[model samples]
Target chain A: MANHAISACAPDASIESYIRHYAQCIDISLKQALASSNAHPKLLEAMEYSLMAGGKRLRPILMIAAAESLGAELERIMPVACAVEMIHSYSLVHDDLPAMDDDDYRRGKLTNHKVYGEAMAILAGDGLLTHAFYMATLAAGSDAVSLQRLMLVIREMAALAGIAGMVAGQAADMEGEQGITSLEQLESIHLRKTGDLIVFALRAGGRLSGASEAQLKALESYGYGIGLAFQIQDDILDITGDPAKTGKAANSDERAGKVTYPYFLGMDESRRKMHELTESAKQAVQQAGLPDPQRLLQLADYLMQRDR
Target chain B: MANHAISACAPDASIESYIRHYAQCIDISLKQALASSNAHPKLLEAMEYSLMAGGKRLRPILMIAAAESLGAELERIMPVACAVEMIHSYSLVHDDLPAMDDDDYRRGKLTNHKVYGEAMAILAGDGLLTHAFYMATLAAGSDAVSLQRLMLVIREMAALAGIAGMVAGQAADMEGEQGITSLEQLESIHLRKTGDLIVFALRAGGRLSGASEAQLKALESYGYGIGLAFQIQDDILDITGDPAKTGKAANSDERAGKVTYPYFLGMDESRRKMHELTESAKQAVQQAGLPDPQRLLQLADYLMQRDR
Candidate 1:
């Protein structure tokens, strides 16, 4: 997997350096997005704590990179990038609530609810979710993107993150936790829960960057293939990856009796499926005829092989 | 108060009839907004439970009436009306969670968490909030309202309902719950928590209807005045109104030991202040030079005299 990632990026620097650079860019934008609003101090504090807590920031990077692949300036789409990350962070905070997953820790730090009280945590999540739309409204225009296109991006982002999308996936996941026994049911949960937002991020980037309908269709296919692979890799890592590397306890899913890709398919079959999906994702990007698909291809490989 | 309300409506029908008619319009719109989504049945069930559970539909009615007073067709801005109500309902669901106000009932029905369980209730709120932006994007255009104007309404709605507005107010109210004593502090909380959204509803209606700068200013002042009066009356009702009429327990605010207008000011002083504010609100609407300010004037009077 590492060899494939390196070979995919041989024409440029390694995927590691690219991810690091984009991650730093995302961090700065996220901070600026949350900066010193006149909002209540404690609420801002809670929002900042979860937002600033480190993660791969993979979603925003994919958004920016996707736009960049289509020849758009990074600054033009920074707000959309930050908005997606804000939505992601808010979901995490709510997911960790006592009434939800009841998680005590996340990304090696105390969960939002563990540090802030449950009420504050809930409000923090609410604030972040509302502010994501507020941030998206700030997505300014350039030669490549019109305000109408930006509005379309905002509309699509909201839909993908909304009830029929991410929230739907979450609701289904909560319901399925009582014992989802079929692979189809598991896929249904993963598709809505994880796939829709990933597709939105890529499609939003494409739409904002003036991709043709055909190109956007290719990106949609690419996003779906990789989204499923990503979740399967997550499931595999839960069983085999080191806790220190994964930022979560190993075998926890099994202990909780949660149905996952590996649990349904076996570790070897899950790995095989992930590899096939990654190949398809890369092929989709290649077929899109984008000016620069190398970075996305490398991203697909990197996601499949990441230790953490 | 009753005499003032009757006199204010002498130019038209009673405000009570106007409210009932507009309330039905809002109910139909709200129902349409929530219909036929492919979201999880349980999640949608929870959202619909809180959303369709009856309230006065006051905010949406105010928005529609304010727009209609300026001669904008109600159908043109129905999306904004429904969106505002969605935001309102989402807040109530989250606020009634055990981690927040912990209420068992709302609008005479079981609170969302009480029926759906906490995790589902939280997801339900998240779903409705996101779905509101989705619904707003669906606001169809007409010859009278431009897309830009509709976008502005959506942007302002999100801002007012987001951090630094309603969410900020909620955070402050939560913080202030630990025995806030000053009248100024209490006023600050009320302005953000309850007042901003109310103001947004009125301003949204005016903006969508192409109100002049002078008229917009009048609506702004009118919103602030009535927003305060609305809360003051709510506080007074908590102390004196019948539970059956209010659909909530009497004196619950006092029992909760939360700060309120009447808690800081004497009942007579609070009543006097509410009356004064209501008069100012009516005057502002009257001064706006709208074609039909009678409904708005009567609304101001009716809000002050409402028993629930």
Candidate 2:
């Protein structure tokens, strides 16, 4: 359900097509939702800044991939994909808030507050996050299982985003901001703060399409691997990757003295671990025997390739 | 399903017992929810300060009253009553933030920030508010109509609390904080900021137990007048109520230049309006001719009569 796919690449399908379709569905729906909040110009402005910000649309891609694996139709799958992205975007916005990470820039643009001020930025995150559930309900339509799945995913995301997941992770983050922490502590913090939502997104997509329990289990394995690998690559890139590609300050994590995988395991070991994690994720996807696993495998590769 | 049967003068339930029962339900559930955030000590403390601070549980009381009107069992109604209070408490914490109202004291104790700092206070509010829906879902059970009804109230509350309702109202309040305005502007602000939630609690309770359309319509009418009256009385209380009972500094609204009902309408007229509104609400309840309008009518009277 969440594993990386490992089939030979489709002869005709391009990543561009996948990107364009996912983007169009999400952008249109997201803007419509943002517009509904238009009466509060400041809040809407801040939301637009974050929601429309450039990214690979990775979380939504994972959703679309999972849905496609189940032979679900485009219309049936689009809403869940968009909803997952909304949650992701919201997490980024709040994580970057003044009280949290407080980065003034993200993806080469002024961060939400840098563009819209702190209060509006806060409200924008709140609005987008809450609206994600609102969007998910539309997908439920007449399907009882879909409704329950959507509700469960929303509940899971909420838990991850609130005290149990992101916030607790953040509390540890802020506490550890002063210095390096144990590798176990850092991993625990990252697993919830950053990893939880991504895993939830993958499994939620599988749930949406009624993927078999066997397939779903594989997806969870894939999700776990990719999620941890994603963090490792992020740790590696923070110190080594080109800032221009990353859209963040070079060595920002190092200067912040953040306890990343690289900091705990050292650069060499961390890089090896990242590759191992990616391989593990790809293997999970292969074992799942998804009809087509190329994009999922390519996505794992893409995670390692990304500078940011 | 929220209306309670309070008989200050009679047997099965007295005002003291009714208020105590509702208050205990709200307090105990709130404390449990707050305890979950104990992983973050400061957050737990911040939530405790505002959540546990003494204030008459008016919203819960309203919810119970409406539930009683629809003949729902008391134990079954407790969760929603607690959820409504959480919504109310979250709004209060956010409102008292430095970026919002910037208050230093509430209930004559240090505000959330004074005790726990700003970021923790913000997170605490976010945690409590997000948890409200989770609590709501528990009480809603598996009944489709019940779930939908609960979601309807929640969506409305979210709107009110977000940019559209409470946040919008709060923005208007913030904008109006330093300015002078007429009675209409003051009334409008309070209507959304406070009145909307109260309306939801009352009507939602009625709807929860499947109240008649005619009965609901009457409840709405009762809600409308009293909602306004409640705020007007609040404004009046700021000037005249016992500070200890009010849990805020005497004349605090005036001191903040809050452009409250009393200030806008003038003291004498505001008091007169409150009485008129209460009477109208009482009359609406009376006209509805339910099996038990005693609680509703008495609540109307009590809303006007309570100086603190």
Candidate 3:
């Protein structure tokens, strides 16, 4: 029934198809813009290496999907989609910097600063982040309403990516590794560090589409639920996920001594929470009266089930 | 004659008055928006400390003056002006970070990392630099010309502030400490690093003012000349500047084995070159037919002659 409702509204487009299309929108611009600062061939090559490496492209797709449900034009959402992905790419690059996470191999590829050398990696991240706005400016070209929407979207991205959001979470994550973490502390750390950006991604898309006030409010609630659901699923997968499909070591998170939902709650309890969060997310979307909830339902299911 | 030109324009606004007027034009809206994102007040405070610190406000004032010259409204220039200042502030903060110059002070005050700790300082700089564009969007509103101008101004600023410009220059400077730089190499680094930003500042103002294409060309020339002149003055001051006036150690450049024009050409030749650059800059503005070149002329002369 859920799939029937979703398909009726966004008929003929598979969730996978939409995600692939969104990724294409992001990669075309991301690769072109960060490629050159002053015709430096090597820096572009390195940025391409990290950026092209297959991560989920989850944030960008979320932004686009949310925007679509609100009736935003494709052009309007592309920039915000690209911007969120760029921010994600930048975080990954910096996390691999010498002063930070430092282990280097990410998504089963050599880390950015490691492959490109430390200095180029740092500049690559800076260039990518700066260029994201250059891309987002495209959205500003549409209308004041659109531009205002873009501004809010980017503000949310920057805040999540900056001190209060990603950076703070990263700091807390770093601190947690040196000691044991209480469940509450761990949740607090993850909320800002990871959850916030994902939430922004969902809500920004809705904003771009000019979703009705009621719709926007509901999407926000949906975003909060799914953002946590996504993280919780990752925690579960870290413990029991298939390495072949996930392309990562199943127990890597545990080995790292990192705090996770699974670490705080037993695996069984974590599973229960994930299911509840996914249901909660679906309810929020339903409450919003989305014309098509099929893909969104699929997304929620994927979030609750996926190992990676 | 100089006094007559100065008097012919509006009465002498003290530096404080000039700086404050520029400040009034800078948007606080973006800052207000980000205020609530704080997980800790210290990070925000550290960011504000450097961002809000008293300086000549040279870059922003240039942008505003350019806007005014073109008959562009104050509202139109505010975002770009703030963006430029944010870039400047980030550079200062990072330049004082542990991996870079490692100074504990800047502008005669405790440096950002000093007050906030290294990690927070780094994050603060990154945050301000990235958030600059979000602020620019708010200022841009719906004017395509203004928006286009914003992009142009931002691209130029990025080129100046990034690896091809200031940051890259810093890299070469630190790396070349053990080596003797030929005059050409020293000039290249300075032109790209320090000169790039100053030139960008001038161009930003010119673009915002809706200057004619020919006028922009002329302003470019103005930027190049003043930028070089400004650096030469610094080289001269490093040798004989009052430590009190500079709020820095006398002859610190020499002690640090920095590459400087004066270091290469000696005091007499450097002064002669600075005079030539200053003359060219003045001629460029004059040829542009600005009704009031007095402030700009005074500005050029002040930069070339400042003891600090």
Candidate 4:
């Protein structure tokens, strides 16, 4: 009964429209979540500064699309979607701190610490990260997902984003800043830092939407393929894309002496690798037997073709 | 049937022995949790440095005692207990950061950033915080606690420990360091910072133990009373306790010019308030219809008299 209802409601909109629609929905949810916080105005300001800053809302959109493609109601998964975006925003805030990336700007504007001071920015990031669990748990109230499923989502999300996953990847990346230049090392770092959370987002959607085992396997493959492709594109953009388009300083990776896919694989090979990954991602979606896999396929192509 | 079984097995050990036993159990769980993580040895090292550096495992111990007082199985609640301690440890790591309290040492050892560098210390804190939710969700597997109940615990724990609670209090405290001194403001900060999580620990135990509504309410009152008393005692100790015994510099709060109960109410009055709070805590616990409330009462008295 649940599967039948979900299949019947599979997204009928175009991929672009689907993304835009869900992005707006997620933005509203994020806004509502933050708006209820009035205890610390400055902390909230710092959090909102980064959270509300314009971006593609990619993580949450991916989560929504992943679920909706399986015919699950997007509304039932908004809390989880918002939570992922919150996690992503918190990571960016911390990454741009003086002790880390030390960037002054993000998303074409001043970074959180640049605007809120280091202490407030750190607290803002902490606030976002902690609140994210609260937000994700909100999904337990939805009729579309069971309590057991939400618990699994919480556990999986934590593992993916915690010590053994994103945090581990981040630690390695920071340690690597002293000049580890191997492609395998960089890929290892990227897999944890970038891939795990992205993969978890899709898997969470599948888990919540009750996707079949085969469908989940396909989503995992799709997630890994696009996660790698996304990082490669980011590296390529750092070297070749315009600052205006990318919303970041062009060639900054080279300036920082950071190892990147382009540097390790060479630009031609990097582009080819990204293309192959994108193809694999599209194929994974195709083979998943989703009622409507159009949005995911187009999303992969869009990610690949993006200049930013 | 559950209530009958729990009441039959209520703890008969002395408070000291009870606490010692549960503390050892919590330490073992914490060690096993960290031991399983092989990724980023340095980050784990930094986390372990603080986690194992040793203070009384007050939060987790409180949780264990709370459950045991009601005759609930302590093993069934260990995950939530360990998670609370993890949250406490993470907060300490971040609080000691150069950007925050700028403390050089904690628990008589070098702070995380001092030993692991600023970036790795930050990641270690993040890793612990994120891992906490993962740990708490492990409670879902226990037959003693239903999945829905565990979800509620996660949500409540996150809220109490997250933005609107500890983080908000820390932010306020940080902002207050610039010279806001008032008893009300101090209490407000202490209530959110110290009180909420302590209250949460007790309530989570109660919830998992299936305490009646009246018992949970009594626990809340007991928690707030002890929480306030705990902070007041801490303030008093900072001014008068020996640094060797306290494991932190005596009079550091005074030197930092941070506001404290003693600062606003005088040392004698602070002592009076601490005694009052402790009495209130004991009274609340006694009023609670717990199977064995002696441990909680003794714990309150112990907290009030502790030099460290």
Candidate 5:
């Protein structure tokens, strides 16, 4: 399952092909990165287990598409794109740990902890997170990407993925369980938790491509819109998505008493908000004057209509 | 104990003074880095709890000393120095988790997990690790350090501190619990676990300072010698040192049925190896033609005699 197509397509074969093309490249780059690690074989196996357990590959795709849209060469930015996915994978691995979400399965397969045991799973997560930086730093080795720009990318990754961004969101999400009072609170949490990384992927791609200040801001706007919309869809899917397709138990969020978009806004309102954000995301990219904004525009639409 | 003197000083007052001066600078830089993070209040507290619970500040001090010895500006490399310490702290935090070493105390204070709970502690460690890259990448923002050099530093960091180095060591250490190992095997494990980071610190410092390849090689040689010697001392200390001074239970390694240098080589031989390695480290620096080798030489001697 991890080696096969991750997304259930949205009827547009071209967009599906586009994603497949980029994801395959990402998968290869990811494997190469792991191969060069020279890590303990058991540890390497644990890392590969979770990292290869594919999902949408959304983050890396977003990064690649954003970079390509700005005329950045595929080979130059692929490392950073894959690095984002590594960060995402590590978070998922840690989230599935017994102390956190304690999920038994992810993507229709055993979670890293389920397969590797707790200690190795923890180290695996640590390995992925640490190596993500290594992958991104590799971009610096290339003359095409300036050191200052690569530094910005590394700083952005660290800032957005660290305590100030995704980690903070996880912390808030956990604390909010004691009391989730309103939609605003939930949105606040998701913004840092989910939105920041999306923002990082888009901005890092743009930055690596030498995008202007105005263009970088535009990517941030698009990232925020899609980031929120994506999470809302995830919440909606928890209730409506099929277990076989989504690779998750039905209504797992509700079962865990997790506060989500639907929990606060209701399904009807949640769907409306998701569409609104998706449209805004498309508009942000369309208006950004990028040489190739078609893929990003389509991605927003595809994300809006995704079933899994 | 965490805030006060971390080292039981050597007989030479000058070496002690050198360490104190550098340690104070490292403390301030580390605080400043964390202060600017703007993480969640609670998360910040958790991170601060572990970070501020200081030990010898050995890694950062080593980085700073190595850089300073080569005429690199302290301000230029201080961020990198603090970054290494953050990585070390994160390793300790994660290592002390119930799923890992399950320790209750460190540096004579409650462990991060003991105080912050398992989940928060995990994030805290994650936070520190991610932030370390942010701090190291900051060196690129300075004009004093060239991007190419800084790029090498970042690459070395991710390589040695990530899966290829520290994480590999940690994985081996955990797996080694299954059986008593030979001296060569024990040394191999400690070399990756401890020596790699030490090597990274020295080489990164050298790279940032525009050290020649021969100089960097010398640093690596010095790092390997002291790294093994340091671990040997730790094992010997487990049996002979005071809990009050060491801040750890006496003979905890033996209690855990862990293999150590002394376990294979015996106390006298272990002590002999430590002194031999220390002398070799001192000789490496003395022969490197560093403009200032006094501090590094003294440090090797200081580390050889540290009680904690």
Candidate 6:
């Protein structure tokens, strides 16, 4: 029944195929990036373990798709795409630490800290974060993007992932452990935590491809909508997802007293809200007059209908 | 007696004056950099607490001196200088975490983990590291350094600080905690752990100042010599310096069963090796034919004679 519902929502399966295509390309690039790193063997192993752990590759795909929408070549943006994934992977590594979320498993495998020990995991996170920037800077050598544009992309990536954006969300999530006061607070936390990086991915891709202000704004809205929808889906999955499929124990959020959309708005309302966001994200893409909004629109629908 | 001996070694005293001058400039720039950051208040506070904490600020000072040797303006390299110090500061914060060094005090003040708790300290460290690159990228906006030069510096900074250098050393040190078998291993650890960033400081400064290949190589040799000497001094200080002065417990390394220069070569030989390295470092600078090598030469001698 769930499969049927998803198929009903995503009438075009081409987006799913494209995601697989992009993921394969990104996997190859990510491997190439780490294989050349002469880090300590143990550290390298830990970093590889987490980075190669199965993921949706959503951020990087969004970046590539955004750039493609602007008629930019994939080769030019591949480094940046890989970089965003690295940032995401590093965040997951740190977020799984004993000092942080203390998760034992992720994606049905032992977390980085569990496998490599707390200290190595921390360094792995640090290493990945630093290497992400190193990878982004490599994009500067490409003739496709101007140095000034690359600088803006680099600066925005740092700001979005640093204290002001992702770090701020992490800090708030920690502080809010006492108790989340309102829906506004929860939304704000997710907006900065999840939305900022998503926005960075899309905007960076657009800017690299010489996006006009209006086009950049459209991508931002699309990114913002999808980011919120993604988080909402995560919240929904915590309540309804299978441990085998989601690679995490269901209801863990509720057990941990974590605030989520379903917790505040109830399951039905949360589902409605998520679909609404996804609908708006698709509309934003369609209205942007991009040369290729089809891929982005299909991606939004595909994400909205995902089981995990 | 120690003060008198230092004065005898550094007869000019002008380098000490220069250190003080450069340190003041760095402090102000660092403060301004953080003041405008819109990071979460607690995260910002944690970053500010450690960044503003008193220390030698040697890395940034070295950067400034290297740039000054090539007649570069202070305003142009100040961002990179501050960026290096930020990197140094972040490493200290993370190194003091309970999972790593378990250090409670640094520079006579409570460690970040000790004051802000472990999780915040971790985030604070991440914030600083990311912001360091952000700070470095700001230099791209400066007219003094070309975009290509700035890219090289940023890449080097990340490499030296990331997996291949500082992180590699840290991993090796942790893995060797059971027992460091040889002096060579100890030297290698310190060379990457402490040396790479120092080398980065000098090279980046020189590069930003449009240095010739020979001048850059000279700075590399000078940096390596001082870097080794610096670690040897740290080992000696761990054994002999006052806790009040050094802001660390004497003989802590010995207590931790960590290997050191003195452990391998004995006190007399360690002292001799340190002085020999410093002498070579001074000679490297003097022979570099830089427009102004006096500051670099004097600083090397002054560092060699320091008690803490």
The residue-by-residue lDDT of candidate 3 on B55-88, one tens digit each, is 6667767766655555555555666666777777
The DockQ of each candidate is 0.48, 0.36, 0.30, 0.61, 0.62, 0.55
Docking class of 2: acceptable
Global CA lDDT computed for model 6: 0.86
- Tell how far residue A45 is off in model 5, in angstroms: 0.3
Q: Locate the minimum summed-lDDT window of 10 residues in model 1 chain B.
A: B1-10
Displacement of the residue A170 alpha carbon in candidate 4, Å: 0.5
- Number of the top-ranking candidate, with lDDT as the measure: 6
Error of 5 at B21 (Å): 1.3
Q: In model 2, state the lDDT of residue B236.
A: 87
In model 2 chain A, which range of ten residues has the least summed lDDT?
A1-10
Which residues of candidate 2, in runs, are more than 4 Å off? Answer: A1-12, A37-39, A74-83, A212-217, A288-294, B1-11, B34-42, B74-77, B178-180, B212-218, B286-291
The C-alpha lDDT values of all candidates are 0.83, 0.70, 0.69, 0.84, 0.85, 0.86
**What would the TM-scores of all predictions be?**
0.94, 0.88, 0.84, 0.94, 0.94, 0.94
The better candidate by lDDT, 2 or 3, is 2
TM-score (chain A only) of candidate 2: 0.88
Error of 5 at A151 (Å): 0.9
Off by over 4 Å in 3: A1-14, A17-21, A36-39, A70-76, A140-152, A171-184, A243-250, B1-10, B14-39, B52-55, B71-76, B102-105, B108-110, B141-185
Q: Which of the two, 1 or 5, has more DockQ?
A: 5
Cα lDDT tens digits, model 3, A128-164, are 6665655665566544455456656666666667767
- Cα lDDT of candidate 3 equals 0.69
lDDT measured at residue B268 in model 4 versus the true structure, 0 to 100: 94
lDDT agreement of model 2 with the native: 0.70
